[model samples]
Target: MTLDGLPERGSWKGLRAENGKCQFLSWKNDFKPDGRFTITFFRDAQQTQPIQTEHGTWSAANGKNELRTDGVRMPDVYTYKLTDVDTVRYVSLASDPSGDCQEDYDFIERRIRG
Candidate 1:
């Protein structure tokens, strides 16, 4: 299964500009077409603890060209463009020009598969 060409199961680690893991998201699907998904979060760089746990269903946002995760916390939505095989930038969706997109993001994650 894939969402906008993203594999259904891959551990995506959030990256800082320096390419450090400061957060994470791992998705799992049962290989069904129900569009159902399970998301896990790691908010710490060291990966010692979790600020948000797994419980959600992620799918493409209709006509918005973004990914939407239902049943999660703050970042329930994300607009992304893959920069490379390993990196994907989850661009911000704020409608105002005054909003900052670089200082922080939904969390840009690198696909975890060597």
Candidate 2:
């Protein structure tokens, strides 16, 4: 059930591998149709221990092929590709100085239902 546009309103979860380690860096991103977003970082995969939370504004651009986020700490722009109805991959447009990983990796997020 792939949608023609971005999943504008939903909760998406993905594990971001940092410094080549992924087991400890997990996050959930909630997007709203009103262009607001909230990102919650967790110390564990189960998301029981939240480390930090950030708020930002997001929008689809370049004919819905790109995603741009504002007020977040990381890269602001990404080339988004939908893998499935509930899965999307975001490739950063710039390098993340805080990531410390040598290899570039795509951030894959899956939409979750409440």
Candidate 3:
């Protein structure tokens, strides 16, 4: 299973450019043909204690994308743009009325292996 060339089941490791934090991680996730996915991200040196884990589903439409997640403690819905097959981008204004919380999870993840 793959999503825009990303392996469905594998671990992606990288460093956060903003802070140079060692972002080691693992994930057991997959994407369906309907453009929906289930993912679990594990960060090695996460600043947020208890770590942050998210489970969400993303759907691609004409030029927009929507991500809805029913997380363990906090659930959120994020809408982003399907820029291309390799990138997905989303943003929310601080004053947005959505129940979603703001987080700084800025990083890039590349395929490693299962």
Residues 1-114, candidate 2: write the lDDT tens digits. Answer: 123467777899998765554344788998877778888889887999999887767777652433334543665556787888888888766544554453455688998876
Which segments of model 2 are wrong by more than 4 Å?
Answer: 1-4, 18-23, 63-75, 95-103
Tens-digit lDDT string for candidate 1 (1-114) = 456655445566663343523223333222124545444444455555654444445455432223334532334445666677666666556322332232445555666665
Error (Å) of candidate 2 at residue 8 is 1.1
Candidate 3, lDDT over the whole model: 0.42
Would you give me the overall lDDT of model 2?
0.70
Q: Rank the candidates by lDDT, best first.
A: 2, 1, 3
TM-score of each: 0.52, 0.74, 0.39
Off by over 4 Å in 1: 15-34, 61-75, 94-106
The lDDT per prediction is 0.47, 0.70, 0.42
Q: Model 2, poorest ten-residue lDDT window?
A: 63-72
Better of 2 and 3 by TM-score: 2
Best by TM-score: 2
Clashing pairs in 3: none
